[model samples]
Target: MSAFEPRPPFYLGIDLGGTNIKSGVVEDSGRPLSSVSIETQADLGPVVGVENLAEAGRLAVQQSGLKWDQIAAVGLGSPGTMDLSRGMLLEPPNLPGWNQLPIRDLLAAKLDKPTILQNDANAAAFGEYWAGAGRNTRSLVLFTLGTGVGCGIISDERIIEGRHSHGGECGHIIIQMENGRRCACGAYGHLEAYASATALVKRAHELLAEQSTRSSLREIPAEELTSRAINEAADAGDGLARRLMRETSYYLAVGAVTLMHTIDPDIVLFGGGMIAAGSTFLEDIRQHIQKMAFPTVAKGCKIEYAELGGDAGFIGAAGCARAAFGR
Candidate 1:
């Protein structure tokens, strides 16, 4: 390379999860140049965890055919109750014993570069807003439906990192006033209790035990019943399975409508493994939203599926870093 050629800005983004640390080097244009993944081994604690995250970023830069100094900044997205201003991890249910640590600065020191911390779901939402489903949209809301429901809101290309870093936690919104299913967080009547993949599976079991109607789901062992299994059954014309799927869609729509009325985002996206339920499932949610929400709110919001798949986290984290460094 000639000295006359200006250096292009690149950023490294690391998404730290309970099972894996995913990192990627992303170009200024929002394309991922390269990515690397490593076992989190989170049980080993924050010290080793930070080391692993730094290693993943190093490997990502090397894989992207760039030197470490080429990275303008690093973004670390993690799950937990966090203090965004201080970059402290207050409490993460999955990462026990990792409380009260300044994770943002710790990772920055490990990499010897400037860094930023973001909530994992927020990072993913920004990824979509930057280059995925919500591209070109002024405001976006994302719901990640997996073991539990996770939400992230982006308005005017900025993440809504609330005062205490709990701004976009829409999953805990109360949807039921009476006796409701319990959320893993020990909360009752939360949207997650009704809409998450875990909740779907739990409801299927309860319905199977209560209803005398024979269905294909009964053939599968109780332990093997998954949201995927139920979806497949529904596709195969099982009445109970279809009903469960419809109810799941209704629950998701309830959550979406609440957000729509509150935020009035231009677009809303649904993501995670459960999205495999496909277009019909999405249509179901749309129908429910149209019924429950104001006509203006329902018609104005463009509801769709997320486009980034598993890569949203790292890419969005990189996007956040780029935004922070004024790239």
Candidate 2:
């Protein structure tokens, strides 16, 4: 019944992060032809950052040796809550002064092409579902473990963008009812509060400061400690680091269990910079999920690491563009 059957040959995808804006030209088949990253310079303000992102898209097209007119559409994945239908980024804290920015229209105007906008986490989930870990399942939830937990819900191969266009925020699910760790959203007992990579580093720092722990983390300056350093320490058989992994993985497991019951997804995929801990990091989450989730769903679901790594967000945005336009 629809006139558009197959989308054009190439789509442009952009990922807007706090530190960098990533851009890539994705073939209709979902393979990335080329990618580029540029400093966001949020310090210079949001307009400058948006301009930089647009320029990065151009550079990516140039790098790919393609003409701008060859691009069918441009898609963007950005952080923070947004009114997706309106294209307004509503009060994203990471990029100060980004309130009510009509990112979709701006990018479209600047790029001189039709553009689509979505949350970065949701974009990553789309990428994985279309081409990465969720390709087989098509029904999956994505948890991006970054500074905070970013949630993406795809049920029956459809992205669930709710009435307010803010429906699928899986990170805000409250796991703690009583006294719990404070979340970035100013709540307590959130999955993000306990399970995010930032939470892991914070928990490690607390354990280190609470008492002397015989681990490499103690030798490093407090500010120098990061999830990566902690993961490396754990890999080297450090006691405190191992314990930290155990504790954090338990929290991540709890979050996974929550996602399982809520989404009933065929697979629950984990992504973001911190999952670099690999199997050791995932083993704990899987073990806990096995014990806690419903028997059948637990057996059926796959607790897997996202295959796309850091590039999922942009790739997913391209996937969304293809889906939205057709083909």
Candidate 3:
């Protein structure tokens, strides 16, 4: 490196969520220079929401000591069904009064830069693939287990967005065809029905009501029960809680094995609030993967936790922008 070497162009990434908008400035090398977080206040309306979204990006650039024009391009990651070809949000359950909004073009016009839009989950995966856990690998799959299960896939350094933007939706994969619990999406036996944080809490209530097990969980009120509480009880060696956690691991393993066989990714990552349960939960998933998957598939792929946390979405969006416009 020398003083004469030219600096790589910068990019801006905006992650629009139901509650908050996160934006960051990033270099071509995947290093984020600055980030800004602001309340989305989506209930106000799309016009204000998009205005705030652009302001967040501009503030991030200001924090980075760069001019708006210095950004090579901009990227936005949003939750909801969208027509990627048209850059319009179709329907996002979390975002009200924002249906059919051309969010991509709105942001582009505000910032006056080339903008690209991506699904929030896919953007998170690209962030990891570009600079986080899977930085060393060419391909990986990420499962985010929170209020609901969300998935993202990257193969050969490209997002598997599918022809109609339905790719990487591994959360809905059916693990049970028989009589199984219903998912929020109205599907029965989907992995989210059994493996997400919401599912774990619901199952805990069912177990407590159906069985008179002498466990610590019975002490917690039904309304206050949460996956984190269950994890804590399991950490304290509560039998019923431990059993529930193990069952969750098994369900997640079933989903992972299915993806491994189909995508043959180099690594599999588990993210979201559940990963905070620590190494035991990850080991449980790995063990189940070994038992259910073919040796060649299970043994070859690395199953690990996602490195990026809340910052993944914006960073990954920046990565996508870099890929599309850095050259």
**Residue range with the least summed lDDT across 10 consecutive positions in model 1:** 1-10
Question: How would you encode candidate 3's per-residue C-alpha lDDT over 17-102 as one tens digit per residue?
Answer: 99999999988778888889999999998999999999999899999888777899998999968877678898888898899999
Off by over 4 Å in 2: 1-8
Residues 124-183, model 1: lDDT tens digits: 999999989999997999999999999999988789999889989988999997997788
Off by over 4 Å in 1: 1-7
Q: In candidate 1, residue 211 scores what lDDT?
A: 100
Greater TM-score among 1 and 2 belongs to: 1
User: Each model's C-alpha lDDT?
Assistant: 0.92, 0.86, 0.92
* Number of colliding residue pairs in each model: 0, 0, 0
Error of 1 at 175 (Å): 1.0
| Alpha-carbon runs more than 4 Å astray in model 3 | 1-7
